[model samples]
Target: MPSRARLKPRKMPTQQRSKATVEAILAAAAQVFRRHGYAATTTDRIAQRAGVSVGSLYQYFPNKDAILVTLAERHIDAGFALVRLLLREALAETPPLAAMLRRFVLAMIVLHEHEPELHRVLFEEAPLPSHVRRRLRERENELASEVSRLLEAHPEACVRSPDVTAYVIVHTVDSLVHSFVLHPPKDIDADMMTNEAVRMLLRHLTAEGS
Candidate 1:
């Protein structure tokens, strides 16, 4: 991982044109990273892909690592947005635990399935900055806290420690969903994966003497 200073973008876009340029760079960087793993991607390649000059690219991002950091930040933000939307819907409906867990699991699968290659590069291949990793951990903790609240409210939940259970649930769903979508087995598919994950979670949360 690079130092925070090294991963920082050179400048922030303020004007409409500058913002568009920044967006173009990020989009191009994502494509480049997807096509060629992070190790092979370069600032010049991203500049060419964005149809911008190297000088212009430098004006916004100091280096490819900076661009990667921005991409990672955007990816994290989009993921959180999706999770929050599902959480809001779950809260509104107050569905059965099975249904809720299924929804969460399916949503995660779908999110990863959208661009599995890009996700793999961002999360698995790229060297994420320390701050970005910290942010991810913080977001996961926040999500776990929300899940804990939901578990506490549910009548069927029999877990002794909602906090611990919620943390486990969040990490389990995230890990399994990512693995199933990004590196699926030859025999198992998304539907099967979701069903098994939900079943396991339901049993753990609601089983007798849990």
Candidate 2:
């Protein structure tokens, strides 16, 4: 039962060299965590993998948990950045609900594809810290808020509750895309899966009278 404070970095890197060292540590951490998983990963192994002294690793991170938390934060930040980009694109065109959903679904699929194993290690398999989990939830809520606005602007999306529908939309797309792309269940075609997801969403959004 470690405190959140124990997970916080001892000091932020200010100099360029120190910054590079931090980046190396993070890159090495990704490999080490993916290779060893969370529970078994140690600061000594991460430092060795990074080609840095263990004392140097401790200069930035207090413990192995700090490194993992930092890595998870970076991952979540990237996901939210993708959401922000799509939010803007969706707003500019205000395409049909299905069209917008398709774009989002595909973009998310690509994001996951780029680093599925690392994502699996950080998000799917590991036991995340409470603060890290809270950060992930906040980013998710931010994406949900964007979806709510997108639905509000979409000419065809007529759900009674935009907020709740937005929650359903985000979770449904995220969970379905992650599960399907990362671990397809026997003979799932990507195009067919995308089409059906779009169809299901369009139905939920435009269905009249509950």
**Candidate 1 lDDT for residue 193:** 80
Query: What TM-score does candidate 2 reach?
Result: 0.93
Q: For each candidate, what is the lDDT?
A: 0.85, 0.84
Per-residue lDDT of 141-165 in model 1, one digit per residue for the tens? 8778878877877879898888998
The lowest-lDDT stretch of 10 consecutive residues in candidate 2 is 201-210
lDDT at residue 2 of model 2 (Cα atoms) = 65
State which candidate has the highest TM-score. Answer: 1
Residue 63 accuracy (lDDT) in model 1 = 89
Clashing pairs in 1: none
Give the lowest summed-lDDT range of ten residues in model 1. Answer: 106-115
| Model 2 score (lDDT) | 0.84
